[model samples]
Target: MQVRHERPMSELSYQVSAPLKLTLEAGQIVTIKHWSLDRIDYPEAVDILPKSGLLSIPFQGVDIQFFVEFETDTQDTYLKFKNLTGRQRETLAIFYRSILSGKMVSTGDMITSLDTPVDLVPMGETDDEKASDTARASPQFLRVIWNVAFYLILSVVVFGLIGQQIWTRISQVSLMHARVVAPLVEHRNTDAAYVDEILVAIGDEVQRGQTLIRLNLPEHDAKLTDIRGRISAAETRLQALENTRQVHLNTGDPTRRVLLQAYNQTVASLNDRNFFSGRDLDDVINAWHDLRDFDDLARLAKGPFYDILRGLDVEIQAQNDALGRLKRELGNHKDAMDAVDIVATTAGTILQIDVFEDQYIARGMLAITIEENRPRMVRAWLSEEMSQTVHIGMQSRIRFSEAGQTRSVMGTISDIQASIDPDISDDFGIIVSVAFNDMNVTQTRHTFRTNAPVTLSASKDWADFGSLIGLER
Candidate 1:
């Protein structure tokens, strides 16, 4: 993107020729075309295209409308917002009106038409000629500027009085503290969640039994299934073995009639040889009994297979026990969540909401705040010497940042802090009270549940303004 800019002091004006062709005078705005506003600070959606081939004029200063036009291409430029403050508002209004009304000549690098009567005077022309050749509306435009200034000055006075009346009822000793803060949480924990968040947010109101985190659970779920499956298999196998044994005892042949003949042969062989007496032949008798039972046949066919099965059963039982213990301890591991009850701990507007949906947040993070709605207070710490002029219940005026718009509560000083701590960064603290005339707007402004430092100014009378102009007090 090529940046084309017209300097403020450039002799060329921002007005154009032809339909709007114009010449410029001192202090006249010149249009800047093809300048990239991509980097310019503006809000999300204010597009002001620098028109091509026309005298350029700065039309917007208030509302922070910006442009980043690309060189020759209409598609490349992005816009930004730069909202003007109240004072800048009036100035830009007059300037923009003059440019749009064709009262000023447009001058810039992208000049499209120079048809305005350019007497073509050389630089060496006499001062009189230069003055006479000036743009026709310069004097009239100057008058418009003066009018804009007049209105602005009047607005300041009105705001001053309003600020004074509002401050008179504010407390002089309200605390203005600053502290580092953490973000709010919105989810639960899981088994994979190894890192535990330790701190909670300052302003978040917490509810009981809220699950704060979620760890990895898929692995745990798989383990549980495996354990239960093994237990069931072991129990079924044990039952099958017991039923087979009972059948063997109920039937002498025991589904092994074919093997009974072998038992008979062994018995006959032992008897014919007279290998031992009845007591000594017990081993031979036991061998014949096994030949008559199917279980005995199965054992002979498979060595230690039953022993292996028994070992597997024991292992399964142990796993089942371990799994049960874990389930009890973790409380199903299904409902863990972190939530907070945002009951109005106090009445006030929600100062801020920290985290947005779907964004991960730390546990116990500040989510929102409720500004205090009470005796209007202007709490400012004063130097030990300055304290001499201040007294309790003395009417005090306050000034808030233009952003603060709390109105409703207003009144008198009813309390004051007796002591001051010099070691503080400000080295002072004071409290002033205003009446409760207004409370509705406190919920909208001047309220904070968590601590965020803000600026406050207080004086005994509405006129006693302080020199410290910076907002963060």
Candidate 2:
């Protein structure tokens, strides 16, 4: 006896009870390879019998099998299938059987089941039973979707509420360059006076009437003394001449008495303090000429007596005129000496000193420059466009940074230049001034330096959205 063995293409194989033969007709059955879903072989109008007296059938690379079974009792042919894997067996059964029985199956249904192989059940489950299981699984999936939707809605609500409280403001921002400025007062001297001492230095604060420099005028004082000495000598000579005239009057010569009395009356009128009001020295000189025509004195005194009296009268008149001239010169010297000390006219800080100690300063020369320290102001220049909107009394903020520290002060717009300055560049536009408030005045004086750079911001009166909404209510 001889035996033969053959291997099936896949794990699944079939065997019949005895040798059987079947007749296959065209279009009666189709054989589809499950893995490739291709019709590898199909039945034709031919007869198939067990080969070599065996009742086994072999397939190539087939995971599922489909066959048309004829039931003799019912006289009906139906589709059936077998598969190796439990997953997707029922769906594949229905799908393949529907094709064999000529029942229409949508391509979408076949593709949908093929795409999701896990949705198919084992071979024993019916289509109605699979539907119940699918219905049972839907609640868990829906709950997961609801949870994701709830989180998304919560996030949107939270962000929307936060955005309502936040605000955004749009403003015109600009950089302002500024400096500290104050009113300046200059003290000067014009006379040729020497600076004996300087009492104040730069950066020193001084009060009103404070002495800044002391001056010495040696030449002026010496000239005054000389004028006083000359006036004293002239006065002494005039007094001696009056004493001599009194002696001549006591001698009782009638002619001499009349001449002497006329001379005395003229001298008395010339010496009177009020004499200069009506008659100048020249008028007194003319009166002396009339008094000199004394023929009677010449007759009374023979030789030398009339000559000596005439000489004495001329000497007295000359001395009195000299004395008056010297006295007027002395008064001018006194005034010059009194103007030596230079004092401040106002309270301020000393900015500069032009003259040094012991230096001779001419009259009308600048000695020191003092700036009023209080009421400091910041000066800035704005563009022509910016100038139109800026006005007096607008709120202002000043910022200054130095040595790693920043300081700020509040102020108000005090002035705006009516016209642009010709000396400054046109790009600088118009000059604007801001006066520091009373509370910050002292702090500004201590922290800010003159001509130091600063930043200034001027705010406009505009309502925000919140404020506008509040106004509506």
Candidate 3:
């Protein structure tokens, strides 16, 4: 078999002296700078080229008809003939060789026209000039910028929400079981007595210095009565001594009256002494001896008047001293009587009454339990996992139900401990004590119970957010 060789078509072009006007479909006019039998060349007018079109060229007073399509190469923009018959190709060849070659195309020369309407399908928007036009029509950069910004903001919001949830979970330590507690003020009786009257019942609100119970203190009462009796007796004895002295004054003997007056003055002076020690008593005895000497000197004339008066003066002084002592004792017994009434030392509500009317109570026995009228506190148990996170003086939030409504208050971690409470039977975890803030105290003063349930929460340090998410070492 013999291999037949075929010839490839030649690529040739020619420049026109004057640009010829070529009109395409859609009235698109382009200036042809170069011409050939197979194609025509023009400056790039649009980014996308028309795929195919029917073209007509006027040559030798007859029109040569063919189909042409746009194409491109490295050097120039041009169109190539397509869908041409052999006869149409030969006609164009003849026309190019004889008349169109080296021709200086002018406005009066051969005119090219497209017959069928060219569909302007978009190819691209990359041409610099056409792209500028498209940009002016609608800004693509701004759209891209806005889209990028929207996605950025959306990402930030999503991360922020996730971070908030994680932070809320880790920043707080919960107490599984907690209660609203207040300090218990125990009212104990220091002296043994019988409860004469129960003035206040359990849960009754009492003010400071208000009597809660009256006791029948038999020993104290007996001692008080005895002191009163002694005081009365002393008063009687003192009045009797005064009467005896008045009797001596009424004797009407001028010398006897004068001597009795002197004796009374001396006794009054001695009675003025607050405390008489052995030496002071000895001095009084010496004064008495001196009075005896005066009496001895007047014995022959006055006949024992001075002696009788001196003895009466001494008796009056003894009654006066006894009255002073009994009165002082009475005053002490009166003070002890005040203690028989068990008055409240502080304002509070009575929690427990251990004794009833006529019940005998011993010294140092708890008579009543009073809950002080003060701010409420929360006692909670923290888990071991949160032991390190919770500490004293940390800020906290406490919540508890009151009158079927939930209420929250700001508080502080006043105390945290691992010790056990002897009063509590169950082993609650680490102890946590929370004190309400001053503003909340006023609102919750009367609302708190000794063992009401409560919940506690605390704020977190934001710098530890990364660590909670495992994003930091």
* TM-score per candidate, chains pooled: 0.26, 0.43, 0.49
Candidate 3 achieves a global lDDT of: 0.70
218-293: candidate 1 lDDT, tens digit per residue: 4555765665675566566656665655554465432365556666666676654476545457656776666646
lDDT tens digits by residue: candidate 2, 1-473: 11222243453232112111222343322332221111112223234411111111221222222232221211122112222233344434444445344455556655554455444556797889878887744577899999999999999999877774442112322425577776679898857799999998998989998888988888876887788888888888899998897676465446545656666676676756657566556645655564465554455664465566777788888888788778877876676665667889999889899999889888889999998766678887777766656788888888889789997778888888855554334564768888887755466667777777888877655743344356641
Best by lDDT: 3
For model 1, the superposed segments whose C-alpha errors exceed 4 Å read 1-320, 332-349, 357-376, 386-425, 429-473
Q: What is the C-alpha RMSD of each candidate to the true structure, in Å?
A: 24.4, 28.8, 29.7
C-alpha RMSD in Å of predicted model 1 compared with the true structure: 24.4
Candidates 2 and 3: which is better by lDDT?
3
lDDT of candidate 2 at residue 302, scale 0 to 100: 46
Cα miss at 331, model 3 (Å)? Answer: 1.9
lDDT agreement with native, every candidate: 0.42, 0.62, 0.70
- Residue pairs with backbone overlap in model 2: 189-364, 190-363, 190-364, 191-363
